[model samples]
Target: MKIHLRSSLLCIGLLVLTACQSTSSPSQNNSAKPHEIAALFNQSTPEYKPETEANRTDKNIDSDITSDSKPIVYDDLWQEVIANLAFDIVPTPRLQKRIDWYLKQPDYLLKVNKRAKPYLFHITQKIKQKGLPMDMVLLPFVESDFRPKVHSSQSAVGIWQLMDSTAYHFGVTTDEWYDGRQDVLASTDAALDYLVYLYQRFNGDWLHALAAYNTGEGRVKKAIRQSKKQGKQGYFWQLKLPSETADYVPKLLALSYLLQAKHPKFKVPKLPNYALTSEVDFAQRFDFSVLASLTGVSKNQLHRLNPGYLQHQSAPEGPHKILLPLTEKQLWQSEFFQRYFSQTYTVVKNDTFYGLARRFNTSVNTLMALNNKQTTLLKVGEVLKIKKAQPLDNLMLEYQVSPYLAQEEKKPVLTMEHEYIIQNGDSLWEISKQFNVPVKDLLTWNNLKSSSLLKPGKKLVLHLPRPAKTPKKPEPKKFLSELEQLVKPNTSP
Candidate 1:
């Protein structure tokens, strides 16, 4: 009887998995033994159905199941966030004051959640993968109010608030065309790398590490040294730092508490583990306008996700990345998509993918892939591969899929010429050195006489040389040794 009961339970479990109505054989008899019935349960298979075309083509697959279908008020990511918070910040009056500041703003929590909806899931998901605390996602909120294009008075830029020098030290590339410090995921990665470095530098004390992140590491270290010299312990709380630096850790802790607080005013969105499978990497330069048309995502939306781009187009030098819905990947790969709308379109107006589909006689799924694969539109009068067409989707921005995207204003450059004004203590040679051009070239570029004195604030034209090719590589050690041997051969004789 015990065996029969156990078998019955196992059979029920199997039935639940495959959605089968019964685990029993139709010809079962009362005389059948419990062991025999149990065997039938083990042998039972899930009901099979023909594969649907939707399954064959990912375009039809519903991303909205998680992105939009569920109620927006509840997010499982919050539970995971609260569960993984292991920070050692003790409650203090300063922290409470910061908490009061955050709480006082009626819209602050909502603002954070609203700006973070698209990225928080991905950030939190990555944090979990690293076994780090989930509250790290709140850093961007504290840094730039989640604004990617913001430039601080301190010269810090991007969501991570990384200064140009600091960004380069962390291996983030900054150039005229692109600044990796402003790139959303790229900056996040660099920031985390810096965080890990700081954590190790301070001997695993996160409080001090976080302080160092806001202020410089040297400042924090100096504070520690100064504190120890004054007979105070070299701890984060005890050390005297700048007023803003002192408030920094407490601010983070206060925000951390609010996220974990489960206050009724805050509604965590439904961000699942699979929310960020959309990010994809492309190893070549691509056009964002065509991508906007293809994916039906707005140009503004694309810029928000990839803030590193200085121009509308991607850098001429790339391996670029864009986030597309997972289901759209299949449709993008479909022959139908290739034949009809395989080509790209540039953004003329803020438009929806569905609107473009309606205007161009294409399917929404066909356009979804295009919208998500944006690259760049760098220079004006830039040769566009996709033909120009006035879009019929003027109201498409109303249905924009992305909630946050920075506006990119277009300014026409009338000429290729660059001008520089003379500054104090500047000479022709110094100006030449600043531009890495020969002084002769500078004179020629500006049509200046050799005897002319540079007037401060006078504008001078600079037809700079094209970027230099890499300098010649040093000869191999063995090659140099052989050269020395050749020269010294008479000594051996």
Candidate 2:
């Protein structure tokens, strides 16, 4: 990339020189009058300067600023990171290549770095607490490019790129209401724990641990066992791992090297390693809509700050916390809680969903989604969920039983089976979560193989489990002896 840039600059320089020579050459001045000639000669033709180092590049070194040992002077988050960076590993050619790639996209790295500001301190602090390799501080960049909510085809989530299984194994709960894997706090805690586990599992060899983090510890162990069969052992580079797994460590090391460069292309933001934060602790499960109304926090901003929440609302259990802006911490606590309440109302004649929506200042669609109701029908005297987490109501009972499990426990709840058409980008796992059904049951009902990919617009039959019935009478405990009694007095025996 640097070579390409330098070549272009050199080409432009040649073009400018050619144009200047054509316009100001002695031969070209032959057409000028005596006065013009005298003026040109008297003025002493301006000298054309050769390309200097400031504008020139080494092409091979790929940078104007050289040496990683010197202190870099850019005032930003990245520069501070470089100043504090401590790593046991050194740069290699592969690392240089990744550095070249990153340098080529000055805007992209800058953007991603800006996105990582909130997370860096927390992640680095945790890594430090665990005595992890400094290179791990930049692992999130290689995983998700620092995009917290970005998902992959492999179903990995958040900056850590933790798969659902890994996330769950690490106690990062994921369900219909929330996915802790996408939460900055939860995911970071889980990721560091998993990293620590890997580090210990591989006997303190960070390279193997890192590779295992990417490709799974089992695969790395298997590769090690294979290498041992050939009388080679405990060497990560010697193992024949998957292509991505092999390149994963190189990518991180390359980033570490680039970050330590004495000269950087851009300034990283100078953000504090620890930023002030305020926590809103709910005594019970709370409605996000009501919470938003009370606190004046927009749901969109909440979503950005709290991506772990799978639904708009937080989990329906106590000890659920929502982070609020530290600047308005006091206002949120004093003002919002005073005004909040969870209340339900009975449907009355002439009361419509639209009217209730207008009363609550919410949309009809939001009401339908919140209540899980269809159509505009409202029966007189029927109870409707107007609000949740009413300060005066029994907030404890609201979350004690999950609606998902409660509905399932009430047998014959589903009136009729239906066929659903698969949509674009739909996966069976996600679909099952949406419908609160098991993926295995979804496959069994459709008579499809587990490995089948869903086709868009393809109809899939859904059959709900039937309720269990009690036996009318006790059945006989007939065995070999009982069967002989039913026969001719056990004569044959």
TM per prediction: 0.53, 0.52
Q: Per-residue error at 262 for model 1, in Å?
A: 2.6
Q: Per-residue lDDT of 331-356 in model 2, one digit per residue for the tens?
A: 43455543563446788899999899
**How high a TM-score does candidate 1 get?**
0.53
TM-score of model 2 relative to the true fold?
0.52
- Report each candidate's C-alpha RMSD, comma-separated, in the order given: 23.4, 28.8
Q: lDDT of each structure?
A: 0.55, 0.57
